[model samples]
Target: MSRNILRHWFSVLVATLAALAISSNAFANTKNYTVTAPDGVALSVQESGNPLGQPVVLIHGLLGSRLNWDAQVGSAELQRYRIITYDLRGHGLSGKPTEAEAYRDGRRWADDLAAVIEASHASRPVLVGWSLGGAVISNYLAAYGDSQIAAAVYVDGVIELKGDQIVAHSEVYRDMISSDLKTHLDGERTFLSLCFHTQPDRPTIERLLANAAMASWDMQSAVQSMTVAASEGLSKIRVPVLLLYGEHDALVNTSGAIARAKQLDPQIQIKLYANSGHAPFMEESERFNRDLAAFIETAVIH
Candidate 1:
């Protein structure tokens, strides 16, 4: 039965469309500031690209920051729109809250996203989430609904934390929360490695490892059990949604997530990258950017 569903799904999956030639003639504006969430966690936010164009918010996954969007932010295709990226509470330049509740409650993460959108004055921006950031989008939709956003894209998103949907790397997760620094860092390195089927360049790997090291220990320990709110969030979205997944993903059960997402919202579009892994945006960037740009264009139009 599952095989049949997958076979049918593959037949109908949306492939990347012809690239959109969006000109970057306008002078792109870059801005940086801090937005304080209702709970007082200061989020580091950055904006680039046409200041007057439609907004696109790029949310990174666990242990990742705004730097994760370097490929998209720097792409000429995306430069035609206003691009926004921000670090989550426990990552990058954002405030790292020590309390367990800060990481466990899904609402706090949702509130943080809402705060960033409101603070940035992004009117009906399209939300794009990667990995754990996908869960953040789910939580945001649950708490705030789909009224504020124009569309949503989930790149290798974690649909739920269920055992079937998530690939088990027990030792890596356990060591990540270990009290010893070496053990924790080693675990983080291993976890980051699992994010790709085609490894990135040496410098990219090293920089991402450093990003992992800077994450809040408390947040890492608590986020494993964070509330996902998939039922309340995903099922309720009325706007367009695109689920982009890599077939070779090592950290997530790609087929399972796709199946679950379809069950929730059969209308949601699906796209699969056969050669890439968890981070398709980084692995097959050119194609990913084209698909994304195409989606953004269609979303903005209708």
Candidate 2:
């Protein structure tokens, strides 16, 4: 979808449209920080907005880094909220244990995120996830309960996957990663390019490649465990849930995830970006930041 089309769909944590979407004359200030999750994963996080603003924890999906939220963290509207975006254990500068067990479970990733929130010293921050990040958030809620989470949002996320497709998808990724791991670096860049149709921001994509190699080689185990966690635990999440899907996302279908999440928690909110797909924040920065800020403004974040 065209960038103009995406603007009407999803939003970002940043206060203004990204430099790619709008003139550099208007933009939000961005900063970077790193924190350790409870499970010992040292996650790299990018933060923006007011120091005294309401806290919002952002999570990126599979093979994605916290840098994916660069636009969100740099938007003027997003300055209203304390935005937190980070790479999962195996995706960014985060510490990745070499053992298979450490890389195999979403619970560990959840612990890492929980630690980030507590480390920030925020009382209760709203949690937001995109794509596989949704699954991690779901698992975090299921594993830790919602005492620290005031609300949550999903941008083109999948709450559940049919058993067969899950297997098929896993197989494809397994083969892809395995074949690419020989050079390791080459594979990560290839994977990133596959994730986005547009050539990504140069420095950001290069940083992603650098971090991917920092991840443990036991990625297959991580993917499998996370898949199972999302499939089995979707019905148990209790916090206020929001599902935002891009209209044309092939990664996570709107109807399927909505129906599944509804079956699990009827209170879940589902919104569709009329002209967006998997990466709505990048595709539609302005409208997304506006709508997202408005939606978050409605939340009584303590």
Candidate 3:
């Protein structure tokens, strides 16, 4: 991240707080495109930054879309990275088929990602996935070849889930998604309070919640598929996997992920932000961008 952008963010943070009292709105613009998933569903791909730069495909979490990645997408430093993001089916502006077959245990979502990669025409591009997006990339690599990906970045979204744990945590994930979008928005407001005790300005926080609230979905399908992925064969993965997460993120513990990464692929790299939660990209944007740039620099982009 450039020092200028850092200073601008701080200024924006202060201005957002002051303006929050008058008019509560400060979201950067996000553009959308449609990509056909393998299942024939039109998934929505949202994006920002330079489109002609080194391609960087971004994936969001469960019940999330490109909007969740607003801060990074809107950052000035992104000029060098063509940051692409999208709404998985059933979330945000993507095509949502209620049929159980659409979600179909999760293959459809991963396939959608594949189509997006091909559509972008990004040869050996870097993939940045968050939470559910992490699993999607994992499944993508497992089912097909990832020689097209120069590197894969998993942001706070790798852990194992299975059997009873699925039912046990369904409500947890569902309730968060099932709540009145309004109340959920409010909750995120409070969540930012904690996630950014250091200094979460109103605009940054509002934009975050707004983008998040737009990510409504029927996650039951992800629940089912991810449960299966909890045990999916990932030991064969040879591509560079860089996992960046938080120390206090309740959804997935860092120690467990670090241990799992080592067990799965001794070649993997891991970084845990001391003051981050589920949304490290937003909470610790500087560190996140720094690590990401370093990783990209190391990647042998073809």
Candidate 4:
């Protein structure tokens, strides 16, 4: 073969190989699936990383979806572990039943989580909950028990669901559940703004807004109305617990909640992000990802 022809062929092969590598890496990191809850609601579930590695399930807060954990999902720190994130009922791409009964009492939340766990084919997977997701994890413990959970991570969330405590700790919650549309929208805007210590980039802000808008107000109200205190079952969780919160969080009283959770389980680990607010994972992603990987490595049971 001519030297010029040989060089051209080699370059073409190199480019083809690079493209194949890129495609393979993308495919290896993301998988989407649908799982049915006990009540017949279907959830949109996404899994990434090594499928056979230690499983970690991430549950997003109220009016949030799996996208809330996008930073963690795509992080290289979590690439060694199997990561599962799903939209809660009435949130994201998950099935939304308009009936009030569907979201009543938080049992459906537990069932939905159970279904996700079952679908992941993971035994005793670590549970990571942010904001209202903490309530879902607590409810899961109350309904299904913690036998299936290897560990738990509560991120700027409500660990103790006492009505008085909730009211006192978060006026944001009050605003979010308000009856007036203007009040609700205003509250949501404020709530999103409070989620970060500094203003997030425009793309991140837009994504957050889009997810918040997708949530059904009626379903949210129903869930809020039926809030059951999960404090009673905190003592029953046998696995390690990690509490993550932002120091500058304007949404919830992070200090009070951490103090309360410590009283319940003195052994629980706590990490406060110095400059972050409600969404530490989004605001301080590098530190959050590192800490999370460490926690899963040292704490979570296989």
By lDDT, rank the candidates, best first. Answer: 1, 4, 2, 3
Best by lDDT: 1
Q: What's the residue-level lDDT of 49 in candidate 2? A: 68
- Prediction-by-prediction clash tally: 0, 15, 0, 0
Cα TM-score of candidate 2:
0.78
Best by TM-score: 1
Q: Report lDDT (Cα) of residue 261, candidate 4.
A: 80
Reference-based TM-score of each model? 0.91, 0.78, 0.76, 0.85
How would you encode candidate 4's per-residue C-alpha lDDT over 115-212 as one tens digit per residue?
89998888789899998898888888888878877899999978765542353425666777788878887777777886788788999888888888
**Pick by lDDT: 2 or 3, better one:** 2
Better of 1 and 3 by lDDT: 1
| lDDT values, one for every candidate | 0.91, 0.67, 0.66, 0.82
Better of 1 and 2 by TM-score: 1
Which of the two candidates, 1 or 4, achieves a greater TM-score against the reference? 1
Q: Best to worst by TM-score, what's the order? A: 1, 4, 2, 3
Report the alpha-carbon TM-score of model 3 versus the true structure: 0.76
**Candidate 2 C-alpha RMSD relative to the actual structure:** 7.0
For candidate 3, lDDT tens digit of each residue in 98-195? 67666646566668888998887776778888877777777777666576778888887654553311113434443454447665555544543434
